[model samples]
Structure formats: C-alpha cells, structure tokens
Target: MDTKTVTDHLYYPVSAQKMDRGEGVYLYDSGGNRYLDCASATFNLSLGYSHPAVIAAMKDQLDRVVHLTSSYQSDPINGLVQRLVETSPANLTRVHPKVSGGSSANEGAVKMAQHATGKTEVITLFRSHVGQTMMMASMSGNAFRREPFPLLYPGSMQVPDPYCFRCFYGQSKETCGLMCVDRIDDFIEYASSGRVAAVMIEPISGNGGNIVPPDGYMQKLRAFCDEQDIALIFDEIQTGIGRTGHMFAAQHFDVEPDAITTAKGLGGSGAQVAAILTNERLSGLPAHHHSFTYGSNLLAAAAANVTLDIVRQPEFLANVRHTGDYILERLRDMQLRYPAIGDVRGVGLMIGFEMCEPDGKPAVKLTNHLASAAMEHGLILRTSRYGYGNVLKIRPPLILTMTQAEEICDKLENLFMAELAR
Candidate 1:
C-alpha cells in the first residue's frame, strides 16, 4: 500500500512506471500505455504474457493439486520429463527436472560432470552470463560479476569466446584455423587446476552481445571436448524452448553435447521451472546432491508441459525462424543508414545489434541511452548485461506475428531517426 516506502526498502532500483498487465508481446502500464516487450520479460516468455494454453493448463492443475513432494510421481512431472527427453537431442535421454531455475540446472550439470569425470574445474567462454548464483557467477565470463564477492567459487576459468567480430586471437574467420578451440589446450594446461570437469557454453552468447559462433565452431569444440575427455555442456537457458527456432540450439548446430541445461523460456508464460537434460554418462549424480524444494512443483510442470507442446509444433517454430530472418534483414538495412549500428547478429528470435563509435569501438553510453529512450517509442528494449556491454538486444517473444515484427522494425526506425540522425 505504501509505494514509496516499499520502493525505498527494495535492494534493487525499479522503474518509476509500474506495469499493469501483459498480453502476447505488449505490456500495459498503469496509465494504459502499451509498449512492445522486446526482451520477453527477461527472455522467459516464449509463448508471451498470459498465454491462454499455459494459463488453462495451470488452472486445471490447480483444481486437481498444486503442491506435492518430489518423492511422489505426479502426472505433470511425468509428462514434463517425457516431453523434455523426446524434444532434446537424441543423446540426452535422461531428464533431471528437480532443479529450481537456470542457475540450479546449470550447477547440477556441472556437478554431474564432476562426479562422472572426477574433476574439479569448469571452463566457460569469455563474456558468457551463465547465472547469478555464487558458483555460476564465479564461473561466468565477466569480472565485474564476481568482483563483489570475496570468497568465490574456486577451480573455474574463462577462455576466449568465439566472437568473430572482434576475435581475441586477432585472426579473421577465414584464416583463423579455429584458433579459439585449439588455444583452449593452453588454457587448460596453464590456467586450470588440471582436473577440468566440463566445458560449458551458450551456443549463441546471451547477454554477451548476441555473439553467434562462427561456422564449424560447435563441431570443432565437440571434437576438442571428446579428445580431452571433458564433458561438453550446452547452457541453453536463454536459447532453448523455441527461441532459436529449433527445440534446442544443439539441434540447430547439429552437435550433441554431453549435457544440456534449460530454463528461462521453458515455463512459456513465466511459470518458474527448469531442468537438466543429460546423456547416460552424465546422469549418475544422485538427486539428493542437487535437488531443490521448488524443483518439481506440479503447477510449474503443468505449465511447462503445455509450453513444450506449443513450441514443439512445426509451424510455430517455422514462424519464429521466418520472423527472425525478417527482423535481421530489416536491421541490416538500418545498419547501412546509421553507422552507429556496427553489427547485427542473431539466430531465430534471439537477436542483438552492436552500438559502436565511428572507430569501431564499443559505444557503451549510446547503447544504454537507446535502451532508456526506447520507451518513448512505445517499445521496451534492454541492453546486454544491464549496460555493462555495448549491445542492444531485440529478442521478442517467439509467438510474434509478421505484422508485429514489422511494427517492431518501424518503431526501431523511428527511434533511430530521432536519436542517431546525422
């Protein structure tokens, strides 16, 4: 009731404008102003806000039962496990749904890899935002994330990501000979504790400038992991559940990882749920080692079941691809008109564009400004990593129609015209 007092007591700052409700891709505020949500409400609304199917399923499940301990085998959990195993890569036959969120799912995968390999270290790509949990924050790419904590998780290291736009090795994709994968040997040799458990990665870097790996990168990485006997884990939390047109990015890239961690978009209309899908080798970890209280809630499982059914539809995924391509093409055209847009990269509906100075340096301030100004154009845009990076992400809901996609581009055009005019 006391809005000012509540706002003052909150740990993190929030916008002055309060949101009332959401539908599909649009969110309405208290004043009834509707704005297109390009960030998909933290990139978790794969089916958009207040999705009918998800709501109906949850409502139905609510009548039957809402809470049951994970010890009991409920229909919702059973269906969710079956659906996940069926949709994930063929190698991922086992599904572990007793994880609370993306962070827990990812940590469980690492624990499985460690238990399987008897190793203690983890290798993640530079700039990757794995999670905010203590362990994940320690393993993630950016230094600023871990700087605040004194006693950080040990035995984790970061290697150069396959960001072709500004290759860390200073070689172009043509003549680079995949130096990024090859050089991991050096990092493992000198930088790690020698006993590396897994190589975790996001197929397309989420919150890391939307950096799509160069061609053959995933395959080469797979081979490298195999050669090293290191478990390969795909952190598909942001890219999974139809965000990438494919059921999983592993399917899109055609390289099966030893394990895949999924969350974020799996709940469709924002139910809190997450799971870790693993092959037989990485499935030996006991449930007690990594289970959470809310891991297998019946209500969340019901929401996930309907979400999976909708996203698994061939037509639904096809529309995501088509719409993504259309938006990418429109952004490329804008890139030519505005020199500030240094690059545009994406797969399916997960897209981002770099804001750069005339000299090709990261335009961090400009990117932040655009995100803040986007609301003026009736659009809600979010910058990568809360403005620590120079990329503006345009990842709308997967259910976006062609007309809505056009509207997004048009609004972006007007935003650029007003802000970036020569």
Candidate 2:
C-alpha cells in the first residue's frame, strides 16, 4: 500500500497513490492514508465528497430514471433547466446542458457564439486553458497539450491575460492602469478584423494558478466586448457553482457575460453535468447548428438542480467569503516569512502561491518537490501551468471548515519551513 506500489500498478498513474474513498475534504487510500484534498479533485467537487443531500438526490433520481435524451423533455431535466434560467442573470436565460465536464461545455459555448454571430475567429488569453477537445485545445494556451495535436482548430487567437503577477506589459499592479484590458482593446483593433466572434476568459484563471485580475478589469473587458459587438464568453469551469464565494465569478465583478460555461461542481459530486448559459439573442440561433445528444440527462439534471439550490443561498456564500478572508490573511503572513513564496492570489476558496527561486526565477523543481513532500505529510496541492509550474494552487472544497483551513495553512507553513531549512 505504499505510494511506490500504488503508482507502479495503477493504469494511469497521475496520483502518488490510489484513492480508495473520499469524504468531505479528505481522500483515503486503501492503506488508510488520509490526505487533506486542497486540490479538490482538479477544482471540481466544490461541495466536497459524499454530501448526504447530493447522494440522496442522486439515489432518488436513480429510482425514477437515469438517462433521457434532450429530444424528449423529462421532468427533472425540464425543472432543472427552468431553475437555471431563473437563477442566471436576466439576459442569460437560454440553457444548453452538456455531459459533465469543462471541455464539452466550452465546445457548446464556442458553437453557440459562432452560430449567433456568424463569425469564425475566437480570441482568448495567452495563458488560458479552455479544454482538451480539438477546438478547445486549439483555444488553450498550454503549449504542452497543443504541441502533440498540431493543426488544432483554426480561427483561434491568443491575447495576453491580465496577469498582474508577471504583467505581460512592464507595469506594476498599482500603476499599470489596467493595461491588460487595454491589450484586449488592441486585439480588437488590429486582430479582430470582423472575423472574431467571441472573447472567452476565466473570470479568474483556474489551472493558470488562480490568477485574479484587478478590480474593474473584467467589467472594462465586458464593456469593450459589448462595444465591439463581440460575444463575451466566461469559462467558469473552475470558478462557477460557488467555488468563488459566488454562484459565478462574473457576479462578483457585476459583469454579465453573453455566455457562461460551467461544470465541475455542477453535479455536486453526484453525476456528470455541465451547462452553457446564454441570452435569448444567442439562443435564437438555429438549433440544428448546435446540439448534443445526452446534454440534459435526467440524473445529471437532478443532481445539478440540488447542487445549485445549496450553492446559491446567500448565507452559504457569505460563509465562503468569511472563510476565504481568513485563509488569505494566513497566506499573506506565510508569504512574508518565505522568500520562495513570490505571490498569493485568487478569490474565495480558489487560492494559490507562486514559488520562486532565490534569484527570482520560477522554482518549478522545488515546487514539485514541495508538493510531493506535502502529499507525504497528508496534504494535497496542485501546480499551475502559466509558463512555469511553480504556482501552488490551493482550491479546497467549499464545504471545508475554518478548522480544516487552519490545519492546511499550518501544515503548509511547516512544509515551507522544513523545505527552507533543508
């Protein structure tokens, strides 16, 4: 049951050890090794593992039905769709469900945007990662993923994300004047050429190390997209469904995107479900152009409906905000003590720390070592992929308590100290 044995035998060895089960914010290996899951199973599982309510909902729905094609409207699917329409921003009413995952939802969004606008070009941030699909992979900025699949989908362009930590433009966060948004303006001016239909972005970059843009940046970009008659798409795969102390990260900035794609936490650990929320304007597009066979399956819809009901509550979100603030404060204190900690960023429960060498270069090797060490010590973390993999992502489940947060922070602090001493 050692890590070595597990990795050697597992089919796809992404983990140090094979997980036997999970409950709340913890994952246990068959050997009874417990790990505090700060990774949140790749930033999904927002409500954590095996919530009683989510399990009950799934079980109850299983008794009634499992899969129902979108061609026929089932009660669970219809009811869930209606709830999504009602809860989303007024302008965004039309709902398109996809099999649970970020990539499919993004694919749906791209098709909708193109269908609505009759344009081919899609622009996104340079460090952004949409998904692994042929089209989504083309839109992603990760070179490693796209390198193998050469000749990815055409009509995709990359613009600089507003990464204040390592600003594409040489400007500080305080005095930069939100040049990141202005770069989008530049892209619209020179690159758009009336061919660009959509500008997709993460309200907060997820796998790109939870990089949060400055206040007003998202709003300004939304305004720019509106003025240019381009559809604004929010890929909230990691930031939606109350991961960021809000139902959607766009809500935090008060920016209503033309379309928003969400997955991960949509099923509340019950079923696989993802959805694309768009306005009537985009939905009015011919249906034949954009359709999925099993998007609104009955079981997925029921699970999603229950998940949304729990996440959308004002009191629950307020708790998230409160817990997030406490975690951020502790991280800031850690940053002061560790020179390797270059930056601490993100909103709500989605947070990260960028590790750097003493010379200020990205300490990728050290970060990987630290993560391995942390896992050995019963904590799980993630590395980012924005040029360097030194950024440590700390996106735990929303159901995590302050006590759990404290334990995580304390363990991380100990890890940092131990590594530095070594």
Candidate 3:
C-alpha cells in the first residue's frame, strides 16, 4: 500500500500507511492507529466514514442494480431527485444528476447557464474554486492552481471576494456598503462582451479561506443578477448537504440562486453522487450538452437518498446548529488564548480559523507547520495548505458529537501550542 510509488506526486509526501477502515468520524490505519478526521475526508463524507445507514443503503441498492446510464430511467432517480428538490431552494425545481465529484458538478452547471442564455461570458470571485476539470479550473479564481497550465479556457472573469476579515477592497463591512457587488457593473460593461450568462459564487467560499460573505452582500448579488437578467449560480459543492447546518449553505444567505451545484457530502459517506439543481429557466440546455456516462448511478443515489433523508430532518439540522455554535464558541476562546489564532468564521460544521502573527499578518509558515504536526498527534486537520496556508479548515462530519468536538479542540490546542510557541 505504498501510495508514493504508485500515484502522481500531486499531494507530495503522501502518507505511507494505508487506512484499513473508518467508523463514526475516526479512521483506523492498517496498524490500528486511530486518526480523527477533522476535515471529513476532503469534506465529502458528510455522515463520517462507513456510516451505517449510508452503507446499508448502498448494499441494498447494489443488490437491485449497481450502474445504469441516464438514457434510461432508474428506480432511485425520481425519488432521489424529488428529495433533493424538496430540500433545495424553491426556485431550483429541475435536477441534473451526475456521478460524484465537485469539479463535474460545477462544470455541468456553468455549461447549463451558457446553454440556456446563449451567452459566452462567466464571472467568478477571486479565490473561489470552481473545480478541477480543465474548463472549471480555468474558471477558478486561484491563479496559483492554474499557473503551470498552458492557456486554460477563456471567457472567465474574476471579481473581488467579499472577504471582510481581510477585505480585498480595503474597506470595512460596516462602512464599505458592499463594494464587491458594486464592481460587477463596471466589469460587465468594460471587461465583458455583455453576453454574460451567469455569475457563480460560493455562498461560503470553501477553498478560498473559508470566507463567509458579509450580510446583504449575497442579496445584493442576487438582486443585481435579476436586474441584469443573468443567472445566479451558487457553487455549494463544498458547503451543501448539511455541511453548513442548513441542507444547503444558500439557505443561510436567505436568498436563492437560479442554479446550485452540489457534491461532496450529498452521498453521506463518500458515496459517488454530484448534481446541479436548476430552475426551469436553465433546463433549455440541449439533451447532450451536459451529460455524463454514469450521471444517475443507482448505487450512489441510494446512499444519497438516505443521506438527504437523515440530513434534511429538522431535528438533525437543529442539533447541527446547536453543536456548531458550541464549537465556534470554543474556537473563539482559543483565539483569545492564542494570538496566532487570527480569525474564526463559518456556519454550522463548515468552520475555519486563520492563523496569524502577533502583528496580525497571516502566519503562513506556522499554519503549515501546525497542520503537519497534528498528524503526528493522531488527528488529520485540514488547513490553508489547500487554500493559502493561513486558515485552518475544520469541517467535521454532520454526525459529529459534542465529545468528539471537544477532542478535536483539545488536540488542536496542543498542536498549536507546540508549533506556534517557538
């Protein structure tokens, strides 16, 4: 099980040990070393590893049918799509299912918007990560990720993120009046050809430092898009399916987008399910414009259906909100004790804390050091290495308990103290 010799060197220094099994938020290595998964294994396993319900659903589905192309209808398709729509925003009534992964979900979404509007230009926030596919990667805002590639797909434009903590526009949320939204008019007028189809935004920026846009910022974008007749696409590929306490992070903003991309946690426990819930407006895309070979896989759909059934429960979401608030409060307390802890922000289980120096600049080196050190402490912590090497991404499974939450904090406290003290 030597991954280094077998796989690409994308994630360098890959773990030598192989994880044999996972159960209830903890993963056990081949040597029986237990590791607490704080990042939900790339934020995909919403219900934690080997969630009983998710596994049961998958086994049940595999017995009936394992794989089916979307050309023909399947038993779980309608039921899963129905449950998804019921839990999704009211405006998004149509469902386009795709076999797992966020990159595919976002690529399909952007295609639909372009197809429906007969437009060519698209807009995304700086630092917002759309996906890993060629077209989607070109559309992303992180320049570093796309630097080595030769000429990505064009027609994608960038805008300032509503990062109030480290405001890109150098203005405070209180007095700035949401300048990020105000710049769209100029970008479309001067930068674009006016054939803009959609403006894709992360209700909460996932890879972009876990940034939560200021209040009224999201509503402003929605209204502006309406005035301009542009489709608003919310990229909740990382924040959807109970990651943010809400079934979708779009709900937390109290506004709706024309379409929303979902993946990651939709399958409950790393099941392969990704989709784009769209409105009737964007359903005009041609039959084969945004198709996938295994788009409506029954096995993953079965797990996804069960996952949504449990996550969308009112009581389950309530518990998430309660527990998430508790975790946030504890993180804030850590901020008080450790000046290295710069900022804490996020909703529900999708939380992040930025590491900073005493003078308030991002402690990039310290963050990298601490993240690596935590693995030795038997906890796999997701930090800004994926984003920018400053913020720690702390998204546990939706099924995490209070005791597990405390363990995470305590473990991190030691990791931070040891690494940041010197």
Report every candidate's CA lDDT. Answer: 0.94, 0.83, 0.86
TM-score for candidate 2: 0.94
User: Model 1, clash count?
Assistant: 0
Instruction: Compose the digit string of candidate 2's lDDT tens values, residues 1-422.
Output: 97678677878747445689999999999899999999888677888888878888888999998887677778887877787777676788888874457898888788888888888789988879899888888998877878886577888888888888888898998998888877776776687665788999988888776789898898888888888778999999988888889888878878889999988888787468888899876786565665667777787788888888898889888878878888899989988988788988878998888888898888999888888889877899888883367888888888888899899988898888788666
Per-residue lDDT of model 1, residues 145-214, tens digit only: 9888999999899999998889998999999999999999999998887899899999999988899988
Candidate 2 clashing pairs? 100-273
On lDDT, the stronger of 1 and 3 is 1
Model 3, residue 370: displacement in angstroms? 0.8
| Stretches of model 1 off by over 4 angstroms after superposition | none
TM-scores, all models, native as reference: 0.99, 0.94, 0.96
Model 2 poorest ten-residue lDDT run: 284-293
Clash pairs (backbone) in predicted model 3: 384-389
Ranking by lDDT: 1, 3, 2
**Between 1 and 3, whose TM-score is larger?**
1
